[model samples]
Target: MIATVVSSYPKIPNRPSPARLRNAINRFDRGAITEEEIRRIEDEVTEEALQQQAEAGLDLVTDGQIRWEDEQTYLARQLNGISLNGLTRWFDTNMYYRQPVIEGAITWQKPITVDDYRFAVEHSEKPVKAVLTGPYTLARLSVDQHYGSVGALAKAYAGALNREAKALQEAGATLIQFNEPAILQHKREFEQFAGLCRSLVDGITVETSLYLYFGDAEGIYPQILDLPFQLIGLDFVMGAKNEALLQSAPFTKKLGLGIIDARNTKLESVDEIAERIRSLAAGLASDQIHVSPSAGLEFLPREVAQEKLRRLAQGVRQAEAVLV
Candidate 1:
């Protein structure tokens, strides 16, 4: 229903010498620093990023995700009935995530996104989106101890996520996004997972969005048409190039077209990104598109991340101007 700018997730890659991120991490890990201190660091980073968005002319902004351990781990830690183990290697380099080992039926220890929403509401002038890892993706990535089928586990996870969603909405979150990168890995499971999420939030007034990254939308086109979300975010940089998926799927949900590459360190040019948007607009209605990065900015250097986001906002403005 609205045009906006979104981040897949932004990170504060280790800062420069003397003013290092390690200083912040060390204090927190050692219990010498307070949560307020960590928040202060996040606030400072968020302020700079938001300013960049405003200058580059964007409608929506994220907190840059300086407060999270990882995109999925934030909510994974809040869920009950699971033991979170330290991240293991899923790919090359240090890429990792909190592995939720199912010990029993999953439920939340408390409201997962309330503090995140509260921080954004109090600190940010632009509308804030509360993000969550989708149930299907979570189940697929983690090991299930009790639930035999991934489908059954996904339903349980979705129910728990719905509770979190309700709490986030009540907390004044303007938008909620379910980040589902694993959707590209398996189509059938992703469809089932997306359906359960829709069922849980049925009739709810919240503006729910499903965010997919790292792969194409081809596999999930059949299910996306019927999903209850008001918006859908995709990683256009890494997603399949064919336009058939976009043409076939109903564009009822606004498209969060990720035009910027988040994993790469090289900054994208405004003109270059605008080209991607131009392509997307060929099939998607103008009003249906929102510009965004492809994945978490944590994968890129902090300076590179900031520059890419700023460029993305600029690209959006340029595209909007031409479209108008």
Candidate 2:
């Protein structure tokens, strides 16, 4: 069994203390510091994020996305022909992201997250996973003036993202996960989304996962199993509809159970998590599962996020003990 994060980790400074990273950003905006200085601060926070996950006994780690802005903007600001505009509320949450505006053809001009992922692999004792905000979510969140339709824009984004995914695969990453929470809301677009997903996942030998969070996926349960990803991550933390899948038959592919809440600061019940995994014993083998939060920990305080990691690692261990 493995303990992993679905996508991001928190970088918020602890309360009552000034954060060097935030301060650096302020200075950077004022032209008081260089981009390298800003990156140095990001590196510190990324190392801290990876170190805490290791200390909590997690087998898989991410860069905590310290160097980037929000998940949506991180890729949009980089890809060709897309510009970032005003902040908009993300999904039903209070959180906001710089809305990506599609003004022209979207293309991947260069490497996006390779340097950060490489740094994570070098610093952590455990294997590192590279995460990308999937094309469907990006298309839904964007202001589409050029593509005329979300499906067309998503397909273009997928073509670009496929190149980026190949870059990560060649960079020695152990896992590459695409976050596609938009599917939970736009369930009617499953066919369009599925075709794009199949093309994006083609030819990647390393482990790949489609991480869906922020809502339930009951509408497309068994049908989603046909997609090509080696693993499917479900958001049991967000909706009861997802947890209901535990009563279904065994999963053919590997699974990721996002039972731990990332939005709430309260630490989870270890016993409850153990039971959740136990419930999945019928549907999945213990080794075929990855335990994680419903989404990124960027919604919580830094300390709370680390504690959640500890809490999750503990729960996974307990589940393993009883499952044996």
lDDT of candidate 1 over 119-152, digit per residue (tens): 7667766766777777887887778898988888
Top candidate (lDDT): 2
Q: Which regions in candidate 1 have their CA more than 4 angstroms from the true location?
A: 1-10, 13-21, 34-36, 39-56, 90-94, 248-250
Model 2 agreement with the true structure over 1-324: per-residue lDDT tens digits: 889998777776686866878888999999999989888888988998888889988989888888778888989998998988999999988799999999999989999998888999999898899999999999999999899999999998899889989999999876899999998899999988999998887778888899999888777887788888988898887866866665664577888888898899888888888888888655467899999998998888888888888889989999999887
TM-score list, all predictions: 0.88, 0.97
Q: Which stretches of candidate 2 lie over 4 Å from their true place?
A: none
Q: Superposing all C-alpha atoms, what RMSD in Å does each candidate have to the true structure?
A: 2.7, 1.2
- What would the TM-score be for candidate 1 when compared with the true structure? 0.88
* Model 2 residue 254 lDDT score: 87
Worst 10 residues of 1 by lDDT: 1-10
